[model samples]
Target chain A: MNSVIHEKYTVAQDDFANAGKASSHIKEHLKEIGVDPQVLRRIAVACYESEINLIIHAYGGDINMDVFDDGSIQLVFKDKGPGIDDIEKAMTPGFSTASEKARSMGFGAGMGLPNIKRVSDEFDIQSSPEGTTITLLFRESK
Target chain B: MKLHELFNELNWDNLTPDVSLDKDVEGVYCGDLLSWVMGNGLPNQVWITVQGHMNIIAVAGLREFSCIVIADNASIEDTVLQKATEEGIPVFASHLPVFESAKLLIEKGV
Candidate 1:
């Protein structure tokens, strides 16, 4: 039997108050499933970064997590609004599009995507004027 | 050094009676950026920064810092202070610049 584990979170723009709750819950779920600590930390970090990106940059969006039967997890983050115009520049280590309010909140450090990339085994970002979507994959360490 | 030592060394004039410098500081982190601190900070470290925003207070709480020192005579809004005080997180202020306070704290072994 194939089992698909699913989780979803609604992210809002500049909602620092609720930021990281999604990642915290995701980490907890992974922990309950006996995911490796190191891998769990990495996944949680990426999940948090993505969730914050949606809240800080995107008008709004949803982040979802899916665990497949084969011991792998995939994260999908989708946002709608003025999408990132230049993926190249956006992915750079110190680039940020965060508002002043977001910066004041300790986000907009310009490390969001880079941090996400660092944590996930495979990462992909697709954006346009209409929306942006980030897909991340982490393989279980056997 | 223990928190009480830093309290004495820094010569903080007013630590709320309810707030206690009651723990040992493992190290110190100085950054205004929240993500950078979260990414780099180890729990139990003292966070030294000029920010007095509610978000800063919240970050320290989530990160479980030893205590937070607002530098260069900076003080957070009353709301932030109230929240911090309620969380059992000590808040201190100094007229010294961040670099100077950081040096003093490190020199004093806090």
Candidate 2:
């Protein structure tokens, strides 16, 4: 199905203050569209964790939410920063390289990526020295 | 119980009542970690934490929390208070520690 709307949000490194704004926006949009509350919460958590990762790990990134006519929502995050060296290692729970500052903020629990994967119905990630991109998909319950 | 009833019963310092006090209290959660709170918190729960950053309001908003109680008399900036008002999530303060408040809320059947 084709996307009905596409929303773009840019996240900057070390912008802890505004880390979840994009996720909040996406959640609000989904709510306004009358998405199921449980599904909305799942999306909100995944989007928030993804957004926070972009802020804490990536130098900078853009989060895009694509809403399709068939009630599926896809979130894509692309960051221009030092990409992850190992996907499998990063996916392991309790594995993190976040700084002390990020940890003190109640983040860097090493659960961000795994949590996102847990909530998302479909997840994809790709990275290189130059940048990284992560895509998360959620399908509406029948 | 509604947030206002709980606040009055507990004798908590009302930092701001601009947000709705009629919101129901589902349960209580205590933590300073923003991400953990966001991931685990449920709607209408009274979030007890020492952190007073504006993101607290944002997290409460996302999770649809009834209100926020800053334990141990943790000070919150005016900007955070303002944001709480904007988000319609009441912000309160307690001289007691988070554990004490949690116990009290549980006793009251939160």
Candidate 3:
């Protein structure tokens, strides 16, 4: 089984109105494809968290979700926004660089990245002054 | 308990009339943070919150929560209500606070 399903979504900065549209669509697609319930929940949380990060923190970015036949799911979050200066500090819970607008929306509690990491089986982050890219991977049960 | 019973018991103003009430709520979760709820809210739970933004509907729908009760009489935005109707997720507004709503729901065996 070498089949692969890839979906792409474009995210705009401060686009709170349509922030979770992509994740919602992906959730529906995954449900239609018969993803495990627990796996679906993990993906849903990680995907939405990642999507909001792009909307609130990034200048702009795109989310790529790939589901392979080998029962592995990977979410690639690539952003062209200002790269994180301190990955360690950013990863800390309750540490936030979010703006007032984001805070007002009840997000930016600095739990987005941590929650995403907690939900995914594998997490990788590559950041620079130019941009940031995060990869989250999960394996579906046999 | 059935949504109608719980709604009547708690005096919740049904925000989405087009969506009927027949869900069996098994638990309750109170939180203002969307991500926190997204990661922890269990299915068939009635989510109590003060955040009435449009994205709340997305979170409730994604988690398949039995219903969403916006506490303290917080006004739900029109877009949020419309999406709730479209997604068939029952939503209600409670004049009481989150704690009161949770207490009432618990008494009602939700």
Candidate 4:
């Protein structure tokens, strides 16, 4: 089946007040479209973690969501600059570079990227001094 | 059990009166780490935490948690309460600590 929905959301760096707005909106939209509850939960976790990463770590970023007719969802997160130094270490749980402000808000447990990968069926990431991009795929059956 | 039943039994302060407490409490998850809870907290579970901030509401809403119980008498800012109300997630204040709160819920067969 073809893609039924495509949406783009821009996130600003250190925008604590508006953090999670994009992911929340995406969850609501997917829910209203009658996405399966379990699959919706996975998407929610992955999307939210990605959103937080953009706000806390990236200069700024955009989250692009594509929902297909076959109940598969793809999310692409692209950030501006100051990319990760080591993807392998970043992928490890309990390894974080989040600021103290983010930790005070009950985040920065070093679980964001690992959790995103845990819930995603297909995950790919690339980083450099220019920026970082993370693509995630979630299918209802898988 | 439902959220209203647990709230009444625990005698906690209802911070968001406009929101409904009729949702089912399928389980209980006690965590202060927003990211940890985001990944581990189950949907419809009553989330118990001491971290009372606007971001907690976002986590609850995203995880589809039934309600939030701010344990240990943690002070919640008006902004956080307002956002929880706006998000339609019931927020409650508990005098009990996190452990006790979770224990009570387990005893109640939540």
Candidate 5:
């Protein structure tokens, strides 16, 4: 099946007030489209973690979601400059350089990327001084 | 157990009165880290946390948590409560700490 739906959402840096709005809207859209519950949950987690990462770390970013007729999902998260210095280090759980404000909001536990990678069936990442991009894929069935 | 039943059993204050309380709680997850909870919290689990903020409501909704128990009597801002109610996530306040709140849920076989 071919891709049936495409959506794009912009995320602002340090926009804690509206942090999860994009992810929530994506989840609702997937649910309405009758995506598998388990796959939907994984997509929700990955999408939300990506959104929070954009808000907490990036200067700003865009989240693009594509849903295929077979129920598979593709999420691409792209952020502006000031990208990750060490992808390996940032991938390590419990390693974080989040600011004090993010910590006070009960975030910055350093588990966002790892968790997103764990739930995603296929994950690809590329980072440089220009920006960072993470692409994640979730299959409807194992 | 159902959320209303647990709320009554714990005698906690209902912060989001407009939200429904008939949801079933299958488990208990106690964590204050929003990312950790978002990644690990299971559906229908009642989350016990000391951090009562607007983001907490978002996490609860994303994770499909049954409800949130703000343990240790944490003061939840009016805006946070309003958000929770608007999102249809029930919020409860408990005098017991996080561990104690989890213990009670365990005792109840949640």
Candidate 6:
């Protein structure tokens, strides 16, 4: 939570059938709130990556979007799933654990997490056996 | 062709026609996978797939697709339908497989 607007989205897992719904809504809401277009696109892209990660990699999760008084956005996605064993390997550009069906659906490209980090001004990912939490921050003007 | 006309030809719901339906649709691409569609689809191409979700609509929006046809007689959830309305992305449903519908739209020069 921050001084600016905050919205929380509940993400469902393996619900491959309904994934990406929340990310789309959040992006639309950001647009309505007058967020900048380039920043909006970056946010939209990151939101989608993180949201899909929740669906494909975890059982379930929650996304928290925080707008700070500093004209920055913080997107936090937390999921209940098996934690990553090697952060370095996961950070590689082309590594993935996505299922065959997920691959057929056009995901598991190993670009999801990397893209999220690339677009954000600050990105942090912490994983444990219990769950994984990802925090992404984007500066609106920088 | 006006998208609604295409709908009439298919005998399906109005789905989604951009506010500018009079504009001609350039081409079509059909796939349920995100990677292939992103890599292969051209602008203004109609995409037909069995995947029914809001992500489909979002991809259409992100890529500026002409319209999305849901094949295999899949119906869109209300949330996705609402997102379509907001994004001005047309949506459709058909009983044909993705490839078959792609063929149908191609025959129509869609």
Who wins the lDDT comparison?
4
Per-residue lDDT for A1-98 in model 2, tens only? 99999999999998977867888889998999999998998898889888888989999899999999988999999999799999999998878898
The CAPRI class of candidate 6 is: acceptable
Clashing pairs in model 4? none
lDDT of each: 0.79, 0.87, 0.88, 0.92, 0.91, 0.76
Q: Can you write out model 5's per-residue Cα lDDT over A1-142, one digit (the tens) per residue?
A: 6888999999999999898999999999999988888988998889999999999999989999998777788999999968999999999999898999999989899999999999999999999989999999999775
Docking class of 3: medium
Candidate 5 residue lDDT tens string, B1-110: 78888778777888899999999989999999988998888999999999977888888998999999999988899999999989999999889988888888888778
Can you tell me which runs of candidate 2 are displaced by over 4 Å? none
lDDT of 6 by residue, A46-116 (tens): 78778888888888899999888877888999999788888788888778888997876668777777777
TM-score of chain A of 3: 0.95
- Give candidate 3's fnat, 2 decimals: 0.58
Residues A32-76, model 3: lDDT tens digits: 989998889888889999999999989979999888788888889
RMSD (Å) of each candidate, 1 decimal: 3.7, 1.4, 1.5, 1.2, 1.1, 5.0
What lDDT tens digits, residue by residue, belong to model 3 across residues B1-110? 77777777666788899998988878999998787788788989999999989888878877889999999998779888998999899999999999998998888776
Clashing pairs in 5: none
> What shift in Å separates residue A114 of candidate 2 from its native position after superposition?
1.3
Off by over 4 Å in 3: A1-3
lDDT of 4 by residue, B24-107 (tens): 889989999999999899989999999987788889999889999999999999998999988899998889999998898888
**TM-score for each model:** 0.76, 0.95, 0.95, 0.96, 0.97, 0.69
Error of 4 at B62 (Å): 1.1
- In candidate 1, position A74 carries an lDDT of 90
Q: Which candidate number has the best DockQ?
A: 4
